[model samples]
Target: MPTGLRASDAPTLQRLCGSDQRLFLRIGQLLQAKLAFTEPALGEIVGNEALKKLALDKRMREVDATSFATLLAEHGGDGDLVLVDGEGEAGWRVIAVVDELGNPLLAPAPAEVGGAAILATLSPALRAPVEGLLHAGGDEQRAAALEQLRYAAPPLSVVSELMPMLLADGAELVRERAINLLVAAGAQIAVIDLVRALQRGDLAQLGRIADAVSNLA
Candidate 1:
């Protein structure tokens, strides 16, 4: 990844970090590699115990142990920094982004997020429930759907469809919430897919993607 998350991203990043400007700025550092990952970049997770255990057992890897920038500068992200889920970008689920050290910058998420391991294995039918909640469900149902978005981190087929409408939500809080979900969705999109999409787009669209991913000042 390059250093280029746009200024427009500021609002969403700030909101996602509970308006903690410092934490949001740190994320900026990680995204832009202002403090790129150092050697021995290891992975750690902040989900529930099960996810942690899975991280320890199934996901651990011994690497060159160096600064993040040097690693990427020399070798590139061989799935070391990004997370993937389901098939294609539509089903991608970003777990965590690492810091200047190769250590993953795990997020503080709901206990249910630990279930992401299992959820990612589900069939595409997961969208059916999300679709119902977005279209017909009442307040409680909508809230439930948001939880799914926040923790479960389902496929984009469902997530992509719900977001545009949510972004248009009239209430300020609702729109902010939608923006948060949109940010997560962006993470789900693979860089390769993003590049392909850009190939089909004009220069302006390409610039937007560049800004979205690596908008360094």
Candidate 2:
């Protein structure tokens, strides 16, 4: 499969990588190679014992294996480097997969879907639960609802409905979950919320926000 990006993506990607020429080049090479990997293949490569029992695997053929391994080792711990969740720009999930052997894969996600669009794609059985818990629920219920939506909706789809509001949720537990979900989703609101807090002279979260933004970037 072809990587979703076009030539025009170079500039944008370079900026995203902070103009690191080498990093940009490595990312570009991986995109051009258009690699796809299965979980078992990656598991064997990464030394995951349970996953290493697979019969066959996809091996590296194009990209530099060493560099790819370094990339995975550096940014692979958290899902941020590979998966752009609901809160990011509505486009492909940039660098969506890394085989841990030598290559990466980029895949498209829904361009931009709202809560309704997300719900429309769900099975009939899931619709009511998702709908009921979407806007109304206690702290725990809201958290579970968000988790349910993860499977039914694209990363960017829920941002409009859940951001900022969830950030300021009355329950500390709910607010914490919202923070984790939004940050994982790559939501800009997370950063904006942090900046706002900083502006209000809240220094306690400064380091945390910086780390979150760094990962998001």
Candidate 3:
């Protein structure tokens, strides 16, 4: 079993230990260098060996108070930090929280400690078709991929890569699907661009914007 200091541990320490009493600890024992933190609400998963290996592979260094505190603040003080390995050229290592269905509450930004490629999740299978959709391609193939993305959300980087051209696609069907997928993916920038498109006289985008508003509601 892995034992460590967590965001919640501070309060527990305060409750158990007097302020004047010096309580000493070490990161090696408390943080274990290879474990992750999950709040009780999600259930206990401490000392997860697979996650420890994943962390080591990602080159996750020792957990210092500063890093732990920073991550805690970033996490809004409560949640799990499950380490998951990334795939493809732009691989990433993330210490992140997930919703009940296991979706990342926010996208993990590549950390400077581990410099990997740019788009971490787009493997060859995904990269080929996403690139094809973004670049020169038949409208039918692009439309098909755009529709598929609603169920299988691509990495945010891929979504960003496809946004410019697809949003302005000449084919109404392709453009509409692209907008729907973007909205579903919760891309705030997509809504901003949709509004901009309307300002630029693309009145056709108004309905998509309305749909996005309804989704938000």
TM-score of 3: 0.32
Compared with the true structure, what per-residue lDDT tens digits does model 2 show for residues 25-138? 333333333332333333232343222211111232232334434444543333222322222333222233433223343333444233454566666765765576566668
Against the true structure, what is every candidate's RMSD?
A: 15.5, 16.1, 17.8
Question: Comparing candidate 1 with candidate 3, which one achieves the higher TM-score?
Answer: 3
CA deviation > 4 Å runs, candidate 1: 1-125, 136-141, 186-217
Backbone clash count for every predicted candidate, in the order shown: 22, 2, 2
Q: What lDDT score goes with residue 172 in model 1?
A: 41
Cα error of candidate 2 at position 14, Å: 24
lDDT to native, each model: 0.37, 0.42, 0.41
Off by over 4 Å in 2: 1-129, 151-153, 188-202, 207-217
